[model samples]
Target: MNNLKYSICYISFFFLFMLSMVNFMMMIHFIMNNMVIFLEWEIISLNSTMIIMSILLDWMSLLFMMFVFLISSVVIYYSKSYMSSELNLSRFIILVLLFVSSMMLLIISPNIISILLGWDGLGLVSYLLVIYYQNLKSYNAGMLTALSNRIGDVLILMVVSWMLNYGSWNYIFYLEFMKNDWEMKMISSMIILAAMTKSAQIPFSSWLPAAMAAPTPVSALVHSSTLVTAGVYLLNRFNYLLVDTLPLKILLLMSGLTMFMAGISANYEFDLKKIIALSTLSQLGLMMSILSMGLPDLAFFHLLTHAMFKALLFMCAGVIIHLMSDMQDIRFMGGISIYIPLTSLCMNISNMALCGVPFLAGFYSKDLILEMVSFSNLNLMVFFLYYISTGLTMFYTIRLTMYLMVNDFNLISVYNLYDEDYIMLKSMFILLLMSVVSGSFLSWMVFSYPYMIYLPFNLKMMVIYVSLMGGLLGYLISNMMIHSMNKFIQTYNLSSFLSLMWFMPNLSTYGLSYYFLNFGQNLLKIMDMGWSEIYGGYGMMKIVKKYSIFHGVFEMNNLKIYLFSFILWMFFVLLMLMM
Candidate 1:
């Protein structure tokens, strides 16, 4: 009964999910058997809609749903132990259910408005999950991720406004408008920017790693499975419409570069989950690049394989942390194999798949991308940009496995891993099994033989073995040179790379978070130019504080004048927004 907290969470979620699962299958059956129809078309407002339409489920969307459900169920079960010791476990389950519902709705939403609605709710709900810990840093990270995604929300709103201005909120009508109206294309570019930022490509990448402040299961939810995947899911669904856009080109380049940078960053991280966080960022970048390159099914496939394998990996890391007094640093763990054999096996296998090793989930999906990129219409430079990052996945995976479980004599034995609670082990075992099977299931669905990232992954040599071998050899050589006890090692090649990749962004975040200052040039610029500066008052503000003029102006006998002036300004801004 001491574990009743988690029990209730599991049962409530399982029951709720079972109900939703039935609905999901019912939806599939309905969609397969008959056309879904909406009746009564008489909407006269922006927020309300009425139209008769049917959304056909393509293989891509159906596959994404399969991942969506599979991941949600796995995370919930994993959460039972991942959040076992925390308070509000039951409420966490409720929120998890809400998040799942919102994501599923986002996937199946036939209209942009409904998608936006689901997206908005998902933001709020996911923010709630991130800040659930209420640790000060978690609060900040959650707020930042929510805020960046809000920028995306604003972009989406811009698209919505443009659509409304063009006559109606119809997606079909908007696409038709794109064929002729430059404004429609501009609006779509804005939407693509929103999607890119929301998915954390390059400069928008900070928030996701910061999101590591959440509990492991929440991190798994955000990184491995649900909310963040929303962006890729949308892109995959809308790929047909988006392929010809210039933003698709920009996305391809940016997302590919992001993949490279993120994989490099993963090498610098020492925190167990932070490594996974960086890896997830890199993986998302890869998925986005593939989607941008006109491979929606491949992107969806990557998402599926990534979610399963990454969830298992996170759960394995969660186990180590859970058992070891919350010691999350890689420096603290060596010979974890001696303590947690089950966890070590899970981690090893999952990492192999992640590193693109043979017969694992990450292998097939990633191979498809490699094949596409290798054969893409794009030039060699762009193709190799992503390919380089794919190789880095192998590097970082080896680094993780070597640092955590591959060392010599055991140093730490702080907990009885085998005697660990059933709930945790059971939760993990479920994910491990799925991780083992997802690779094969996905291959069958895609009608391709499983190709490994390593030698002899399958009965038939479907993978490009020479490329895989070349990547491995290059990785081994780099590892040796970087770790060798020579002049270069003394100068510290690996540490320098780590500093540049891992510590620089953290430093920049600190540097850029200072109070804004743009006063002297502002008043003239504000009046002469239309761009208003929201910067701090600087010397003027300091002078006001020193002289007490600030209080006097607002609290003096001239307060009514001030109030009237403020009202007039508010009215002016409103006038501009309307314009």
Candidate 2:
């Protein structure tokens, strides 16, 4: 029975993937001819749009799905053993299939409603799987993660509402709307708020670290490579919508803030998995900023390259924890190069890729993003700021690589290489291979027509040189600083001014619902405390939670408050109904 279920997932995955692949080939053929389908047909609503099934075939959609399939397949195979001691195998496999299906659907969705449905569905499956452990911490983290996603959804829904009313329900309609309207600015702003929340952007990012409660395979599959990137994916999917709007500028601001903070968080985080998790947040922010600039091609390339190195890194981290009695703290891991030579080798290469060493995969993709930022004609000052942040990314990436592979600190016994897992090694090496050449391949494609898209190769080389040097310098600083101080570089909290250091975007069970409630509580206190001083010239004002007319009105839960909000919305609904 277990074999039957396992076979079912593998079969379904391949079949759907092939179907999407064929659809994509057809789409590219259509796109080259500038064909546009009317996404909706009342006769059957059966418009076969290219974007609708791009999950397997469209250049942008297919690129991301490649990462999805690569990591997810290995995860399933790895899980065959990882879950060997567990019961409920079928249930787990089913959820994994559902999760993959949702992501594929999202990638190819031709319309906004379809995309949102897929987005919400993916979040639900991820939440279910995240709590797969059902331990106290896992359950808490799952519930918290779910709440954060819901908050993001709320922001998206708000934008959808505005677009449908002021713009149009169809996503393709944004191009037309942008030509004649300003309302898209508000819609874009709202949509990006949703994006930030989904990507685990700053202040809202704690859910990702908490998400480490799930199995490592899930970490590599859902959290790192696929679902967490959905928000950025959406932003890129509609790159044209933000082309030259104020919302695009706002997105740039959010991107810078998120990347800077995420890098800092990664710097100080102690857990191996959490460090990667934080790094995912930081990199996704960098990706989002790049996407916000209307550089779809660059964003897609980065997505592909990041998946290769990140998966390799996480798989190695999994092996590290497994061997050291599930030791996840970086402090507890050192001199690891001795025992697991194969893993050490893979980790060393993967670390180099992450640090953007030239000739490595990261060097190309990350360098393209920075070079583009340096040269975009419209925003000179903004590009300069982004360039500076790229330098920050360089510093942190070097810090991480040095701590894992080269440092003389925290020496410990290294176990023998875990060659029992050949698939794991193969997966890591495949990514490493791609990491080395993806940039070159992408560069060749772009430079195919130099007059049309002239890449500043000379300038690009200089930037790469500077980026690599920055990483080396940062690594050296950590090395010398560590030996002299005899302590971890993170001990001093070098990035304390980043206020997000102390706050979690969605820390506990209480989320926006709690925030709104607290807002009301404070407002009521302000009125109660100040009313007597203003009205009667200073008798005491009671501090009380007891029922008063205004207190009752103010203390209603989110539902009733929403109910009253519905009354205001009724005016609009009735107005529409009357019209």
The candidate that achieves the highest lDDT relative to the unseen native structure:
1
Summarize candidate 2's per-residue lDDT along 186-281 as a digit string, tens digits: 676777778877887765777887888888877877665678888888877666667877767777777777776766666566688887777777
Those runs of model 1 whose alpha carbons end farther than 4 Å from true positions after fitting are: 1-4, 16-62, 172-180, 408-415, 446-508, 511-579
Candidate 2's displacement at residue 348, Å, is 2.5
TM-score of each: 0.78, 0.75
Candidate 1 lDDT score at position 460 = 26
The lDDT values for all models are: 0.71, 0.68
Off by over 4 Å in 2: 1-57, 163-168, 377-388, 392-394, 406-417, 444-502, 505-579
- Which residue pairs collide, candidate 1? none
Give the per-residue lDDT digits (tens) of candidate 1, residues 1-579. 547776776676576446546655654665456544432244344445333232435455555666666667767877776776667778887887788778866776556676777788888887888898788888888877787688788887777777766555556435543544677667667767887877888667888888788788777767887777888887765565676788888998888888888876676667888889889989999888888888777787788888988888887888788777777878667777877787788889888778777677887777767866655578877866766786677767777777787654333644455536666677677667777778777676655445333333341233344336535544554346545533443356766765355454554355433221234356567754433323345645566676796566667768788889899999999999999
Clashing pairs counted in every model: 0, 4
Q: lDDT (0-100) at residue 432 of candidate 2?
A: 63
Model 2: which ten-residue window has the lowest total lDDT? 48-57
lDDT of 1 at 212: 82
